[model samples]
Target: MFILADDMGFGDFGVFNGGQSSTPQLDDLSGISRLYSQHTSASPVCAPARAALLTGRYPQRTGVIDTLEARGTDRLALDEFTIADAFSRAGAVTGLVGKWHCGAIGEPYHPLKRGFDEFIGFRGGWQDYWDWTLERNRTPVQADGRYLTDVLGDEAVGFIRRHKHERFFLHVSFNAPHFPYQAPEELIGQHRRTGRTERVAVIYAMIAVMDRAIGRIRQAISDAGLDDDTLIVVTSDNGPELGGDGEESADRWNVGLRGAKQHVFEGGIRLPLVLSQPGVVAAGEDDTFIHLTDWYPSLLTHAGVTPVGSKVLDGRDISGSFTGGTVDDVPRCWQWSRYHPMPTSNAAIRDGRWKLVHPAAAGTLGLTDRDEWIDHDIKRHPENYAQPIDEESPGWPAVGTEPMLFDLAADPEEAHDLAAVHPDVRARLATALHAWYEDVELDRARLVST
Candidate 1:
């Protein structure tokens, strides 16, 4: 069981939030689970992070460099081998319940065609929480008055029950606290009564609802007698979405980590990871630097299934590391921008305790008018936007030419810059980051060209 939350920060967990948000269920689960304190999402944004998570490769290599589906930037290349493909090849029933932002166009990019035998979710980055139009294996299902989060949770429980007798790999993805921040009035009132601003209240309420749903899913798993057999992994796709500056902003407690979603800072990519399996994986905290991509090979190896492709994978099988085994200390890199990727913009590389970042170019930080239109088109008329369309380049001016360096071991919040103090380290990491950009961009170019 792989459970994901959208736009949930480390502070959103009740165990870390100092009780600002309600996540009692997750707090309880944390007691018996192995908490990875230094885990990170592969990307700062949703589509690319998901791409890396599913394919065990960098997002650029998978042709999912950005999140605009109408412009086709979010589509995962068909040639990629997904974790689902690996699990399904091992004869497990694979199901995806919730947001499927990796692709949102034609049937070719659908989850049903991407190794998932069962898919019940939306295929877009954002959706209307109240008037959601979901699909169960390509068949549209209109909202039936239930909250969207509850609906997805119910579907996950049903999947578990139906496949209790068989080997299954279920991905329960919850789009909580992402957008369309709507929650039951009761939940909102509880947070609002605590003096939280309206936006923060709504966001917390949404997360509270999701927390309840997650608890229910866990109960269902236990009821089905899969507690000992199932390996449950809980994590988020990326950091919380901080709204525009104001008291009404969506910002809440984020453990004092710098930056928010769409940034390359620790707060953007750093996330909470919990793995639980009774008597198999011990309960404790592991501060190893684990990336989202690691789950692909790790989980497959844990299930005693060989990876299903000859394609090279960027992730290492760290299943052994869960139980006092050594983890490879390797550098992880991330880059993102609107529309086409800008290698020099919003890019970061972490090699051991040192991190080098090229802050986003100011002009490239937002979506263009056409990008906004494309997003709207995909949400409203997905059929009409099934194919990619040419987009005019923003041609934004570049900034932040000088890279910023931080020693995360001493400054996990990335508050201090060590670039001038450690020029040699900065130069070395910068060269490596540029080389990585060139390599991944070459693969992306080949994929798009063909």
Candidate 2:
């Protein structure tokens, strides 16, 4: 069972740093599950991150670098091999019970056609919690006045109940705490009692409700007697969406990390991960760098199935790393250039403790100026929600022309830049990052041509 939270930050959980609201269920889960302290989402945005999570490859390679449009022709290519397909081929029941933002316009890119036997969720990037359209295996269904998060949890629990006797790969994705900040008034009042602002209180309330829903799902797994057989992994698609007015509260939830979502900073891409499988994997904390893309191969390996496709995977199986083992400390590159074929903005590469960041202006870098690609919530509530921009934000600095280098080991907040101090490390990492960009662009070009 894989549980994914939408737009949840590292510090949102008590296991990470204890935000204004308590997450007792997740805290207890961390006590029994392996806490990955150095895990990162594959992308800074939604659709791309999800694409990488499902395919075990970079979103750029899968042609899902941007969020899909409702009327546009952009979609995840049908040729990409998915983890659900791998498990289903291995004779296991597969289902996805949450946000399926990978693709939605056509049947070819639908979740049902992408290897999932069951899919019950919304297809767009954001949906209303109180009222929204839902589809069950590509068919529209009534929501029945239930909260979206709870609906997903109920569906996941039902799937587990029905398939408890067989091997199942259930992806219980919760599109919670993302936008509109809607939750029960009781939950909202609970956070408000903590002396938090209205915006922060609403966000925390949503998170708290989501945590409880996850706890219910966990209990369902335990009750089904499939805890030992299920390799459960919980993580988020991206970091938290910090509003413009709540910097202090953001620090409380983000643990003083620099930058927020939509940037390549640690706070944007870094995530909190918990992996548990009872007797198979031990419970402990690991700082090994794990990407969302790695879940594909890791889950397949844990399911005792060999990958049957000839797709070139950018992710490595890190199942051993959960059991007091180590993985290769190689350079990992992350890029974010929406609506552009070439990656030229907010690109970064991490090699050991040194990280090189290439930040560019909004209009420069040959990237498309997607000024209208604002979040729905932000558009509805501009004062309450804000994009992670440096001009309006205090801690977030403007991206300079010169690439910056930071020793994450010493400066996790990215307060200091060592680009000039350590030229050798900067040159090596920059060269590698540029080379990686070249490779990604070349691969994309070849795929486009063929």
Best by TM-score: 1
Per-residue C-alpha lDDT of model 1 across residues 102-184, encoded as one tens digit per residue: 88876788998888999999998988888888998889999889989999999999999999999999999899978877998
Report the C-alpha lDDT of model 2 over 1-450, residue by residue, as the tens digit: 888998888878866664456799888888998888889888887888998988898888887766634322135667888898998888989999988877655567778888899989876676788776688986787658888888888888899899889888898888887876688788777877444667777778888878888888899989998778778788999888775665235334587788777778898899989998888788998998888888888878877888858988888999888787998766788887545533446888988899988775454323222434543433233334222322221122344346899999999999999999999998888889889888877766676787
The C-alpha lDDT values of all candidates are: 0.89, 0.77
The TM-score, computed over Cα atoms with residue i paired to residue i, of candidate 1 is: 0.98
The per-prediction CA RMSD against the true structure, in angstroms, equals 1.3, 5.8
Error of 1 at 38 (Å): 0.8
Question: For each candidate, what TM-score against the reference?
Answer: 0.98, 0.90
> Residue 34 of model 2: what lDDT?
89
Any runs in candidate 1 off by more than 4 Å, and if so which? 193-195, 398-400
lDDT of 1 at 287: 85
Top model number, lDDT: 1
Model 1 lDDT on a 0 to 1 scale: 0.89
Which pairs of residues collide in candidate 2? none
